[model samples]
Every structure is written in C-alpha cells, then in structure tokens.
Target: MYLLTLSESKPPNIVFIVADDLGWNDVGYHNPEIKTPNIDKLAREGVILNQSYVQPLCSPSRSSFMSGYYPFRTGLQHLVIISFQPVCLPLNISTLPQELKKLGYATHMIGKWHLGFCKWECTPTYRGFDSFFGYYNADEDYYNHSLSRVPFKGYFLDYRDDRQPVRDQDGVYSTHAFTKRAESVISQHDTSKPLFLYLPYQAVHEPIEVPKQYENMYPNIQSEGRRKFSGMVSALDEGIGNVTAALKQKGIYDDTIILFTADNGGWVSYYGNNYPLRGGKFTIYEGGTRGAAFIRGTGITGNRTYDELIHAVDWLPTLVSAAGGSVTGRDGQDLWKSISTGSGENRTEFIYNIDDDFPPVEGHAGIRYYFFIFFIIPMLPVLMGDYKLIEGYPGLFPDWYKPDTEMSSLDDPVEEFMAREGYKADNGYQLFNIKEDPTEHNDLSTKNPEIVAKLKARLEYYRKTFYVKPNFPILPDFAADPTKFNNTWSPGWC
Candidate 1:
C-alpha cells in the first residue's frame, strides 16, 4: 500500500529530464571533477537516489520507463532499434503521457524520442503527447541534428516537430535548442491545468561534440574525450538550470515535481564514467544499470539521499500516483510514500534484464565501435534482497577508481576477457551480495548454491512469461532507404 497526500487543490505538474549516456560518477555531486552546478543543486536540495537502477542499454531502459514494463516484456531487451527496423515500442501498452492526459493534462515531449518511430502510430505525438519536439533515433550529429551511421550510411536528418522533418535547426546545438523548447513549453502552459513534460536530452552521447566553450571549461583534464564530456555535462546542467528557472518564473516551482536522471550508465570508453561502480554501459554490472538520479519538488522531503533499491519501471506508477492517478496494472510499484517515510522498503528485488544468447541474425543493430563489440554482453541479472545473481559474461570494463587519476581504463582490446575460463560457468551463474560486495569483487555462486538456485528459478519463470523473445528483429532487405526521401528518416514503409 502507498500513501501520498497533496495539499494544493490543483494537481502537480510533473517534469522529467533525462540525460543520455550520463555516467554514475559524471555529475559534480558524485565526483568533484565534473562540473554540474544545476544538477548538483537539485540533487543536494532534493532526495538523491543512491540505488536507482535502469536497463544497461539505451532503447531498453527508455522503453521500460515509457511502457511501465521491463525490456524483456517489450522485446527491446536485446539492442536498440536502427533506422531500418520496422518495429517501434509495442503498440499495445498505454504510455505514461496517455495515462496523465486522462486526468486532463497537457502532455509535451521534448528532446530524444528513442522509444520508436518507425511507424507514425508509434511517434510520441501519435502515442500520447499533445506536442512532440525531438529526434527519433540515437547518436545524431549534435549540431546538424542528423544521423549518419552504419545501416543508414548517409547524413540523414532525424530531428522532427511532430511528424514533419525539422529543417530549420541546422546549425543550432541540440542541447540549447531542446532547452529553449522546454522553457517555451513551461512559459506558455495553462496554469489552471496540470502539465506533464518529458525532456530527454541528446547530450554526452557519442560523436561527443560540445560547443568549444563547454570543452574550454575543462582545461586541466588531459584526455580530449573526458574534457569534451565534462563540457557537455556543463551545457546539460546549464540547460536544466534554464528549465528550472522557467518553472519558477511560471510561479509553479512549488507545485511542480522535477526529476533528473541519466537514461543508463555512462559510455566509459568515450566521455562517460561510472567510477566506484563496477563496469560501464552494456554489461550487467552495477555501473551499467545503476543510475544517478534525484526527485525534487512537491511531496518531497529535501536534502538527502535515500539509500535503497529502485528501478526504472517504478517511475511510471510513482509519477502517475504523484499526479493523483491510479496505476492498477503495471509491473511497477509506487515508491513516493516509501521515499517520504524513509522506509526504503517499497522494493527489494528487480530483474536488471533478461537477454537471449546471440543468434547472429543478419542486420542486427549495434554501434559500430570497438567498445560496442567488446562490451555488449547479452545475459540476465536478477537482484533478490542482499544477494544478486548474474548469469552471463561480465565484460572487461575498468574497475571503480578515483577521478583525475588515470582510469584503470574501460575495456581491454582482446578476446581474453570474454573468453576467460570461468566467464560463463557450466550452469551460467555467479552470485554477489550487493549489500556486502557492492563493487562485485567476489563470486559466491559456488559457495551459496541455494541462493543461486532460487534466483535461477525466478529467472526461469520470468523468461517463460516474457512478452517477446529478447533477440532484436532482423532487418529485411526490402526496407526503404532514407536517402530516397531527401535524406530524412520518416515513418516510411511501415
């Protein structure tokens, strides 16, 4: 049972901000090397979530947050959707914005819409949001707002306003543009009705380009990637500050709930770092899944970090409940009351991800990078209470380390790590007492047979009940080329 009582007659406006590929230790509050004053201020003044977990990859974590179900339930457990894939988020689930609009909310979505847009029906505007402004894919050129990568080899524009291609934002930096759009939404909003704004950023991801001014802020850092990353984070922080100021200027700061989180762990190989947490993105490790997050505003008791376990799936129910809506059927538990009470007991178990073994299907979606092949391990991890069970290959990402010092480094460019003898056991299980071994130093699968067996049984049940197979859909040869439509990706051939 959950208890949340709001004093104001008007329902609270909910604003959720997500930073793509931001690491656990990349924030100023978490690591002193990073410069994020706005994010740090929010985290310091609000409740810091020390144990917030999300899926290891981009689309999976995003889909979970949007669908109120695990990636395994959405068929996004394997990998991200490429430009050529005909699938989007399953057309079945009633999205978060849809639920909010039922209570008379004006829902708006700004910045990255990586959930899925191959079909116009799956676009945020079509799905639920009254207004949508952003791109439909990942790793787009930050300045030109274009995506030119493998599978779709030319600079195809993915930025959009509702369904039409956005051709005007050619030279504008994506972060600044999205920030202005968000502020505009807040300023023009009808105050009498509640508003739900979802702003997912495109900062600090690959093609790690930030304006020279942001990179100039980090002169002392020697690594170019880390330097640019710090600057990108600064830009993101400043934009967040701008959004918060807009909320305050609208005279709704007290009645608005502002949440900030990275979609998943940092891309350590590039400009991300999840230091002090084992491994980086794509591994079923703590660094890959645990998020740096906080919730500030109405009903929040401020200035503290609530130390406990929470999952990305929980946000749907928690935010819906915070807005005075009922979430009767979802794979998530509302945690607002538990957070307010400092009980930290609303959740003690959650499955990190349920990944299927590689089947080597043609035209699978994967970032064409050295780290992508080295680090992307397909597996399952089920966390139950103090002991957590991992049933997959643990890639060789760097261990937790102090900042400014050289990172032990992300992943070794060799097959030895993935080919280690004990990497995948006979039964494919390894146990770690997360409460005790937070960095996951020791393996207890051999020692604690009963715990391993219990978690395995739980995984078996979840695997059987999954909504779809974890493997990504194979791209068909007849998929339409974006180049034919004047180099703009659209809901074509769907």
Candidate 2:
C-alpha cells in the first residue's frame, strides 16, 4: 500500500555503507582500476544499483540485512557465524536497529559485528544498537585487533568500545578505525534526532592490510594480492570521503540517506574481482549474487541507473519506508516507490545456499520470478526473460580464470571445472540468452525444451514451499560439548 511520499517534517539521515568482501569490479563505479573516488561520488550522486541482490555469504548477507528475513528466514543460511558460536541473530527477531530505535532514531553501530557475539544478549548493544563499536568476530587483525581464530582456547580480543574491552585500539587502521567512528558519529549527532549510521566496513576483507598511506595509492597494481587489494579499496574509498564529509559538516547533507552496499562477491581467493560477472565469493553466480549497489541521500534522484530488482532484504523496508516509518510484517519491499520512480520491477528473489543440514539439502538454490532465474546447486541455472538454463560450467573458481600462478596447482577448481567441462547430470541443461549471452557462452538448453520444462517447474515450487529448517544454533561439535562453550541462552535469560 506504500507508493512513496514522505517528509513527515524531515526525517532523513541514515548512512548505511556495508562493504566487506566488496568486488564486482571493485568500485570507481565498476572499475577504472579501482580508485573509488568516494565510491565514485556515491555513484555520481547516487542511484546505480544495476541489479543489486546479495547474500552469497557474510552471515547470509548480514542476516538478510538485519532480519527483514530470508537468510533461510534468519537461521543465517550457512557459512560464517564463527567465533564463540553459541549462535545468535534470533533474540526473537525484529532488528534494523530495532526499527530505527522505535523511530526516534540515533541508533549507531560502527563496523563489522559479524552478527553474533554469543552472549550479552548477542551484542550490537543488546541487538537494537543504540551504540556498538565493532568486531565481534570473523576476521580481524588489521594491526592486531586480534582474532585470527583461536576461538574458545584463548586469544580473541576483537576490539570494541561500546561493549568495552578495547585495548586502546592498538595500531588503528580498521579502515581508519571505522572511519573515525563514522566521523565521530557524524560529529556528535543529536541534531533533533534522526541518524542511523551502521557503517560495517571491514574493508576488502582478509588480512590484506592497507595503510602504507593506502599502499602509496596503488603503485600500478601489479598484484601483491592485487596491490593489497587496491590498498584496501583505497582506504575504503577515503573512509567514504570522510563519511560524506561528516554529512556535509552535519548540516545533514541533503537530509542524508546514503546506502552503498556489498556484503558478498569478490574473494577470488582474496585478490577479489567479479569481472564480467561469473562466480565469486561463495558462488550463486552472476558474480555471487549480484551486489555492488547504491541509493544516495534524501528522496534519491541523482545520476541514475536503477534497473530495479533490489534486495539485501530491500534495505530494511527501504530505509523504514524512507524514514516516515511503519512497514509492518516486513520481508522487505518498501523499495520506496521502486527506488524513487525509476519505475517498477517490484522484487522477487529467493537465491539460496542452504545447508546447516535439515532436509538433505546440500547448497545453492534460486528463484527470482518476473524475468525468471531458477537455479539448483549442481550447476543448473534457469534465468528466463533474457534466457539462461545452464547445466554446469559457470566457474565458481575453475582456476577462476587461472593466473594467480595457475591458482596454486588448481586445488579443486569446482572439481576441476566439472570434470573438464563435461558436467553431466544426464546432460540436459544449457540455454543462454542472458540478454545475448552475458558470458555463459551460448547453449540454449537444446533449443528450449519448453523453456526447460517451464523453469524446472518453477524451481520445484520454490523448493517445496520455501526451503525450510535452520532456525539458528549449529556449530556445536565443541569437542563433545565443553559445557556448550558459554552463551547458552540470552535475551532476558529466564
């Protein structure tokens, strides 16, 4: 029922950001050799979003953007929830900073809280984030912030300030201490309340450490891990140009909405590059769930390029319905009038990779409705509308285009590129119109066997009524329950 219209006496100021494994042509508006001029000036004032979509990893794309649901409905689909695990992100869900701190807004959160802290009510300031500094686990060490994994047997550290335990943030450089705590939380916000922040940024993830003055601004990047990952994406694009000049020096730059995405894609063994879109990060292909997005301040409207089809659980009901608030029973789709009138495409994405073990499911799943896109793990594909039915061979690292010294003896490049490209599941799929073959290299599933049996019966009816199970808690084997390691239960621990 929302068709866009807001300005309940000015409510803007959101900021968001994200960016961990970041790639899909590593910024500078999709690579001009990655300088990322402040995310290419927020993709030239903002809009871009060529096709968005996420959740190929990183705590299931941050638990589908803090629970607008769908990381297999919040069990956090599969990989990444590591350090101290007793599981999390289910304190009876309802986040997105507890619906923008119940609309009075000011809900902070600086950087990388790999979505679970084990206890203290699963951290992020007890889950609604009135403030949270950073690092809860999953990758740290940018100047000994610790955690290179030694989970319960000691050495964790993981830097924090809001929840304390901050050993004077050792040699800084966690993307310049999370962009100087997001420009000191936008220079001590409070301007009549209306600020969300949520930076994220564990820059170009990995121990690829930067700061040698951003590795002397990439000396002609000859690959020392892609010039330390283009100097950690040019120090996270100059800390997002000092957080958009601290929101235009706190006059709240055009009221401020911002966004900029990425939680997945780009990790071709860490020199990360989703070039010409294929497979990367943990593979759902289309370069690991098509990320590299955008949004930009206020009512949006800037250098355009929408292409609809958004996701990452539609930015928590499209920034809580662009701050006027109220987006009830949300599974994210407020998309603020299809991203401010760039026209419609509504939204229909399933995209999966389930496997915390529940119904003999192994990994990779898909759906996308209008303009079709079915898929199924053992290289199935599907796609429709711009055709694509593929049945194997999409490179989830078949020497992912080799050349990193032949990827160290090709250690299982998607099982030797599916047995040197023979991929047989009774050899049946291979169509491709990906709008004139966006590089699946033409096949046409044997000239459309009735659109591959009608997109494989709509991906088997969304895998039997929306793929179930996995409601959190699974990383147990703590060597036969060493008293289940700690945080057994929280959230008003009865």
Candidate 3:
C-alpha cells in the first residue's frame, strides 16, 4: 500500500475531498452535459471507482468515513445530526484525523462538519483537527453562512474560523472560502509534516445558490434548479482545481493523494440527477449508496476503473496505513495496496448501512417517509459478493430521477416529478444483483431465495449483536434553540 512512497521514505500528503449529496451521474465523466472538466480530467487520469459505496444519508456516510464504522455501530444510523441534535461521532472512537495526527500528520478540516456539534468536545478542533475552518451544520446559506429552515423564524449563523463563529464570512461563498483556506494550508504548511486536509465541500447540497457567472456557464440547462445545481458542482470543481494548483505550486502535488467522493446519492427533491440508477438519496438503492469516487495519488495507475467494492468506512484504515500508522479494531480494511497497485481483493463485501433507526418493519406498507409521512420502509442494505439485500425502507425517492432531461420544461419540478410517482418496491425485503444490474431495477429475491435469506440472516445477526438504536427523544431540544446563543448554531448548546 505504501509502495508508492515507501522507497522515497516520505509519507504522501492526503487530501480526502468529499462532495455533499452529489448524484452518481452528476459528474462530467458520468454525464457529458455537466461540464466538470477538472473533475473529468481527474477521473480520466485517476483510478475511477466504478463500484464505490457509501451510506445513503449525509451524517451516516460521513460517520462511516470519520469513525471507520457503520452508523448502526455508532448509533448515528438514524437521520442526520440535525442543527439541534445532541450528538457527535462518539468520542471514544479514534477518528481518521486523530489517527493520522497520532502519526505526525498535520491534520486540517474545512467545509461542512455535520457529524455532530452539541458540545465543544464534539467540534472539529476537539476531534483532532489541527485547524478547522467551517460550519457545524448543513444546508446553510451559500453566501451568508446561516441556516434557516423556517423563513421568518430567524437564521442560525454556523460558519466558524476554528471554534469562534466568523460573521465576516457572510458575503463569501463557501466553495471559494474553503478553497482559499485549503490553498493557504498547502502554501503555508511546514512541508516537514505530511498534511491531511479533509475538505468536505458544501456545494450541490441544498439552498442551491451560486454566483451568476457559474449559472451562466450552464445556460443550456433548462430547469432553473438543475442549472443552479450544475453551477454549484462547477464551483466546487473550480475549488478543487485551485486546491490542486496550490498543491503543485507548493511542490507536493506528485507526493499527494487526492481521494474525491460524494457523501451520498443526490437528493432528487433538490434537482439531483442519478440517471439510470434507480432511486435517489435516502435509499438503499445503488443510486443512493454507490458514489462517484476516484483516487489520483502518486502511485495509482491512471486511465483505469476499479470495479471492486470499496466502502466509505475503508478510508480511515486506508489513510492511517498510508500515513504510516496502525489502527486496531476498525471495520475498514487498508486499501492502500489495492489502490496503489490494483493487485489485491479490495473488500468483497460491505454493509451499505445497517440502520437500526426508524422505519418499522411494516416495510413499505404504511405511509411513505420524506413527504412528512411515517412510512414503514426497509432500512438496511448489505452487499456480499455482488448481491445486495435491503431489509426495510427501500428508499424515499424510489426511481431514477433525471431532472435535466425527464422534466426539463418545468421551472421548479420537484413536486410535479414526485407527483408523477415513479416506482417503489412491492415488498419490503428486496434483493438485487448489483454486479449485473447496477441500477437495482431487477429484484432477484424470488429467484435467488437462498441469497436473500442469507443476506437477511446477516442483517438479523447484525441487529442482535451490534445495532445501537437511533433513539432520539421524540421532541427537539428547545435548549438547542439558536436564540440562546445570539442566534447562531454554536457548540455548547446541549
């Protein structure tokens, strides 16, 4: 795994870039209409992960990345750590940053930190980041850096420079701000220490706002939401380009490892296009969990696609191994060798998510979730040797959503598209041959009953042994109200 720089005797700098809620087909390499030239070049030059997998939600996938454990294990298998949720990536677990830092890596973080931020200890600085410049929540203002779920209720300022909230970031778009910070980190680094910059960009999530120039770049896109979403993607791509330029300028580009991936599938409700892959974000389907991932490091072979399975949980051990450290009891396997030389079993199976959260076993029989209905749906999906099994809550958005083409004529097409009602699983317990049908279109459960039973048994065993219930008190913590902290979602609320 370390063969790339093992001879040089210098640990390569690691830059793990995570995109928030980017769909499988959003990238230019996946979809030509999305003009992400920089990303396309990176994918073309890097080893594109053709079968990369992650959790179906923001916090769950991020928790997997940070903790090297599934959400069920961390009790974060439920919904995301909301602006008011009193949770953080359990403190006992050693995070990826902490592990790398223990091995003398200079760790830094920028952009979204939706893992948890209830107390000062749960914030990034306390979670082992040498320096953290970002917010603690999601869907904040692209410009003003505030989160406003209710129009007139008031906006919570969430942006921060380290632990102190930065009000001056009001005018700066997050993509630009984070990009500059990353460049500055590279430019100003001691160089004596290998840097680990975990930049989880806030683009392409929600509040899909971007500068007019970016919007102008996608003038051909008919739907306003899709155009804006594409623009946001471009903005993020530009930021990445800038960061890479900074790395090269600092003379560490060749000695750096850039791992780029989306946290989860796109939210079709917010104009995300997953194309042929069935189901959007918040689903167990391939479109929701199979991310667009690529790695361009010093040793990875370029112009190649790795079809082997790699999960979000693998990053912790893989990176720690690359940083010349040992991690014990992690659910992740070191892929440094497989990624570096393409000559190893890069994880044959992974739990897409063992969500022991909500979604009772009624299994798609009750009301559908997301539309504010308490739908009983399948929640868990595990992949073992190309066969995927979903135990409950198959998905919120149930089919392939291509807003760019499917309903391009509509000005704002979210409601109308859902109104059209694509498709859903007839029975809750669903199975698919992910190897052949990457889109979860064909259910092989009836024909392959043994496979389904085996996978279901695995889920039951997981539930019995390791599952930590995502039991949030049915009420939002009123004490977490932003008004208490001068109208900002700062730590120490809980």
Better of 1 and 2 by TM-score: 1
lDDT of each: 0.77, 0.69, 0.79
Model 2 ranges with Cα > 4 A deviation: 1-7, 22-170, 190-204, 209-263, 266-268, 271-279, 282-287, 290-334, 337-345, 348-444, 447-494
Model 1 vs. true fold: TM? 0.89
Q: Who is ahead in lDDT, 1 or 3? A: 3
Candidate 1: deviation at residue 28, Å?
0.9
Off by over 4 Å in 1: 1-5, 359-385, 395-427, 476-478
Ranking according to TM-score, highest score first = 3, 1, 2
lDDT tens digits, residue span 1-494, model 1: 22233556777899999999999989999888888999998888788898888877788888878878987777887767777777788888988899899988999999988877666888999889999899998988898988765566778888888878899888999999999999999999999899999999998787779999999999999888788888999999999999999999999888888888888888665658887888777666788788999988877777877887788888898898888887867777889777655754467578877766463111111110000122336453343348777765543353564444343243432233344422332335668877778787888889989877777777777777764675356664245478777888777667
lDDT of 3 by residue, 1-494 (tens): 23334326778899999999999889999988887988888778778998788888888889999999978788877667776667788999989998888788999999999988889999899998999999888888889989764322787788888878898877888899999999999999988888899999998898889998998998888888888988999999999999989999999988988999999988887888787898877777777778999988776666788877788889898888877777878778888778767886557556766654444211221110111123346543344346777765665776677666444345444445445643333446777766677777887778978877777777677678877877455567776888888888877766
Question: Model 2: per-residue lDDT, tens digit, 113-180?
Answer: 77776567878888888888877776767876775333344444567777666777688778888898
Let me know the TM-score candidate 2 reaches against the reference structure: 0.31
* Candidate 3 residue-wise lDDT at 363: 21
Which is the better candidate, 2 or 3, if ranked by TM-score?
A: 3
